[model samples]
Target: MENPAEVLRRVFGHEGFRGLQAGIVAHVMEGGSGLVLMPTGGGKSLCYQVPALCLPGLAVVVSPLIALMEDQVAALRQQGVAAAALHSDLDEEERFEIRRAMARGELRILYVSPERLVMDGTLDNLARREVSLFAIDEAHCVSQWGHHFRPEYRGLTVLAERFPLVPRLALTATADERTVDDIRRQLVLADAPVFRGGFDRPNIFITAEPRETERAQLRAFIKRASDGRGAGIIYCGSRRKTEDTAAWLKQDGHDAMAFHAGMEASAKREAHHRFARGDAVIMCATIAFGMGIDRPDVRWVAHTDLPKSPESWYQEIGRAGRDGLPAQALLLYGPGDIALGRHRIQESPASDEQKRIERGRLEAIVSIAESATCRRRALLRCFGEDLEEDCGACDACATPPKMWNGTVAAQKMLSAVLRTGQRFGLGHIIDVLRGRMTDKIAQHGHDQLPTFGVGKDLPDHTWRGVARQLVSRGALDVAVENHGELLPTDQARPILKGETQLMLRADTVSKASTPRESSAPERGEDPVFDALRQWRRDEARNQGVPAYVIFQDKTLAEIAYRKPRSLDGLAGVPGVGTSKLDKYGDAVLEVLLEAGA
Candidate 1:
């Protein structure tokens, strides 16, 4: 049997394991079960794949989506591995052939959806064979505390019952402490060792702006980040917004496409294929579009609305810069998004305990967005990881926002909420604070209150910003049951009683600002790199696969910079594995020679 390191070098083309991959792979190869908590682009798949190659029998992997299964199978096959996926999209003949291959012990790795794996007789058939291990990808889906929960994942617990001896590896990119604990209990892997890779992705530049002229903000973000050279994804909160945003971007001369669950299957596939192939297309999509994507050179990800939680936000933004290159993440949100999020939690069918968990999650993300300190630190704190110092990559650390003493503003806002009996939303409270003579304020007799016009000096937008900051700081809460009323929390008592000082970001009260340039080192334009990318694009189109599957931009850039003249020199590049060097060595050298390398 080949060791994991040899398999890693000869098969996957890398020299060694990253972070906890080596230990995780060794543990699995030794017939031990465990859970893996690694960030996206951390090579989680390689942990299971390398072990499967070293093991004796077929390695069964439980994946969530058909697209994920197919992409992994395609990439593995390109590396000369006998991998196959059993999915509904495959034809009957393809399924039959895969079954035959499995029976004959020809396939080293097999990927199947959790739903398909738990089907009648599927586990029985697998048990009759020599199964090596069970790998559960996107393991967070099994936990109700997770952002994207699927009921089908609960059935996966039976894998331990049926294949008790086979090693099980549960993997996910996003999960808090609660979600992680829940995943362990739900998957029946409570005793399994947990390996947690750092949740920080320093390559991703994070920024958030209050939604002021959202369309214009989005356009400016795309232009600055992509420069018509890189791909991007804009996540919207609704299906209609995806379509509208896509159309608007296209009108502005961007290569944009809309993708949503509402689209037909064929349409979705085509959109996915285009996104996978095109170098500079922007995908305007709901949250449904990003999970299974394997594109490596995506330069940016933007959110037109607030994500449900910090976990979801991290997962979505982590999709960019998968190749460890510099990428940007811009989030645009407003009070409306916050209210809607709270309202959704209030209206959910979940029990009180679950609702409380979700509400905390919502508030956590809101605080991250409105935070005046290091954004990366706050985000990592959600997953129970602490960044000792500030990450200089986020917008907060890049260009520090001016902060002011908002204690007076907070007191005035809280006083109005209390005087109004906390029954009205922000708009009504703002009216009473600004001393606006509205019919509702007049009817409620708020004009008679001492705190009614105490905040009259501040503008409406300024008061709104103060209210949002107050909510984010846990000094106030939105009562969705009372039609989005503003209510003071226990923490508010100190501010209202002049016992606590409140500092707020000054820019939140001012006009929205543009995202700053990423602090990551910029790559200068190289003729060799450009020529190599063109050749790669053409070759990938000829082979009908994603360009990254052929040769990642990082590899091509390295080759262009190093100017590898011979096949041996080309083989020295990091991503140039034996299979790729053998297959494309001559062609790559030819391109280099033509470009005067």
Candidate 2:
């Protein structure tokens, strides 16, 4: 068997391992199992892919989605490795071919969906051959409480029962402490060594704005973020919102498409194909779209509504800058989102324990949105990680927002809710506070209430911010059966009594500051880098593959910056393996030399 490092450089074209990758690979190579929690684009695949190549038998990789399996197998095949994915999408002949290859030990790695792998006789076939190991990707799916729970993933424990000697590796891009523990229990990986990689993605600039005009803010953000030169994803909360937003973008002359589980399979497939194959296209989608996407060059991710939890938000935003380039993540939320989210949770039939856990998760995300501290710091804290210093890339650290003590405002809002018998929504409460003598106020009798019009000096947005912050801070609650009417919680008693002070971001109408333009000079400014990218794209198209499959943008940028003059020099750069050096080195050198000339 080949060494892991040798396989990494020769096949994947990376010079060495990153973070816990080396240690994890060694453990697995010694027939040990482990659970790996790494950030998106943090090279999680190498933990398994390298070990699969180094091991003896057919490495069975349990993947959740067919698209993810297909993409991974495609990239591995490009490196001259014998890899194949078995899924429902394949024809009988293709399945037979793959089966024959596995039987003959011609395949190094075989990707199978969890459902298929757990089917009757699947383990029998693998047992006939030298089954090297089992790798479970998206292992967090086993956690029933996780954001993207897959019941099928829980059945993956069978791999350990049947193939007792085969090492198992479970990998995920996002998981909190609870999800991690649940994964261990469900996937039977408790005995496996756990490797927790850093959750930080400094390459992605995080910013969120309180919704003013949702569409207008999104349009401006798109203009500022990608400038129509890169690809991106815009996440909408509902299926209808995704379709409408996509249609709106198309009308604005953007090359955009809508994708959601609600769409027909063929239509969703077409949309996925277009975004994967083309550059600078915007995909307006629900949360259904990104989990299986392996496209590495996506430049930005935007959310038109609140993500359910900090974990989900971080994973969604982590999709950007997968190629290690600068990227942006922008979220726009309003009080309605908070209300809607609470209503959804309250109306659900989930167990009380699950609901309580989910509510805590939601509150954490709300805190991140309303935070005056570093966005990265708040986000990382939710996952049990901490940054010693603020990340200068996020909106808060870039331009500190002004904060004001909202203790008095909190008391007024809570008093209005209480005095109104806690039967009104924010709008009615705001109307009461602004002293609007509407028919409803008159009918409720006597604008003589002590709290009415007390908030007249505050703008509508300011009041909205205060109310949402109260809900986020547990001082206020939304009554589910009452159409999300505001109600004070026990926590509100302290704040109302002046024992607990509330501090909130003051400029409610002001948006989060846009991240500074990347200080590193644009790659396009270097002709050789541009030429190399063009060459990679052409090569990728000719081979019918994604450009990153040929060489990552990071690798190409390094090549351009180093301007290697010979094949030997090119081989010395990261991502230039012996095979790639032999296949494309001359072509790359010619492009670089011609650009220099």
Candidate 3:
């Protein structure tokens, strides 16, 4: 059998394995089971794919999404590998052909969803074949503590029971310590080695700001980040917001589309198709749109509202910069978003332990948003990884927020919440603090409270910021069952009793200065690069696949920079495997010559 390196070079075109990939491939090839925790775009697929090619029999892969399965199959086929996917979308003829190929040992890899793999007679049929290994993608779904938990994934544990001798690998891009433990226990891979590729995407520039004129902030972010080039995804919290944001962007002359779970299946497919094909399209969507996407040139991702947990936020932002290119992620949120997040956890049917876990996750994300320190460091801490130094890529590291002694302000805010009987929401409490005689304040007789007008020196927005910071600091909580009232937590006692002081970031609309340019190596203006990109776009269009599937932007950039004069010279460039070299190498040389490369 060919070694993993030979398969990687001849098929995948990559010269060498990335971090931990070689170890993972060798382990699986040696009939050892393991768990892999790698960040998105970290070459996690190569870990399993390389071993599957070196192994003896058909390697079965369990994937969660049809789109993900189809995309991988298509890419693998492009490399002249025998790959097939059995999904619900396929017709009977296609399924029959795939089953025949598997039985005849004509296919090297087969992809199936968890539901289909666990169905009656499915495992029985597979048992008849000489199976090599079982790879479970998106393995975090099996854990109840995961952000994207699906009950179907729990059925996957049977793979170990049925194929005890076959090497098994569970892989995910996002998982905390608790979720990791749960995945191991549920999948019964307790004795397997766990390979953790560190969780840091330095190519992604992270930034979060208080929501101030949401449309304006998003528009400015898009312009600054992408300059109207490449693809972007705007995540909204609600279905209606997706539609409204998409429409608004379209009105502003962007090629925008709305996607949500509420859309018809055909509509969602069409939207996904357009996004995959178009170079400069913008997708306004809820969280439903990201997991299945394999497109690598996404230049930016923006969140109009806060994500429910740190895992969700990390995964969502990770969709950008998948090609190891410079990308930006912007998050716009407010106090209401945090309150709603807390309220949802409180109202969930989960047991107290689960609720506590979720609440901690929510608070962790909130800390990331309001943090005055390195955002990347704080984000990595959630996954139990530590960054020794500040990552210069995040907005916080680029432009640190100004912090001030807010002990007096915190006292006033806590006093207002307490004086209002801890039964009023932010708006009403703000009204009382600002000494505004609103009807609700009059009805509650809050104007008579001693804390009334104590904070009148600060503006409404400042007070709102203070309230948000207080909630984040655990000095206050939102009472969702009581109509979103503000309640003090035990941590509030120190500030209320003058036992401790508080330091808060000075919240303002202009907190973030002009962002510094990304530290990533610049792809300078090379006419050769532009011409090659156009040629690639045309070629991809002719083939009816996403442009990146033909060749990633990073590979194209290298080609343009190198200006390889012959097919052999082009093959020397990364991403030019034997299959691609035999297929499109001459065409690439011709384009380069035409462009005076």
- Return the top candidate by lDDT: 3
Candidate 3, superposed: residue stretches over 4 Å from native: 414-457, 478-493, 513-519
Give me candidate 3's TM-score against the actual structure. 0.94
Q: Model 3, residue 42: displacement in angstroms? A: 0.9
lDDT, model 3 = 0.88
Better of 1 and 2 by lDDT: 1
lDDT of each: 0.87, 0.85, 0.88
Write one digit per residue (lDDT tens) for candidate 2, span 77-104: 7777899999888899999999998888
- Tens digit per residue, CA lDDT, model 1, 305-347: 9999999999999989888878889988877688778879888
Q: Quick one: ranking by lDDT, best first? A: 3, 1, 2
**lDDT preference between candidates 2 and 3, better one:** 3
Q: What's each prediction's TM-score? A: 0.90, 0.92, 0.94
Ranking by TM-score: 3, 2, 1
Better of 1 and 2 by TM-score: 2
Q: What are the runs in model 2 whose C-alpha is more than 4 Å off?
A: 414-454, 477-500, 516-524
lDDT of 3 by residue, 393-454 (tens): 88888888888889998898888888788888888888888899889888888889998888
Task: Evaluate residue 400 in candidate 2 and report its C-alpha lDDT on the 0 to 100 scale.
Answer: 89
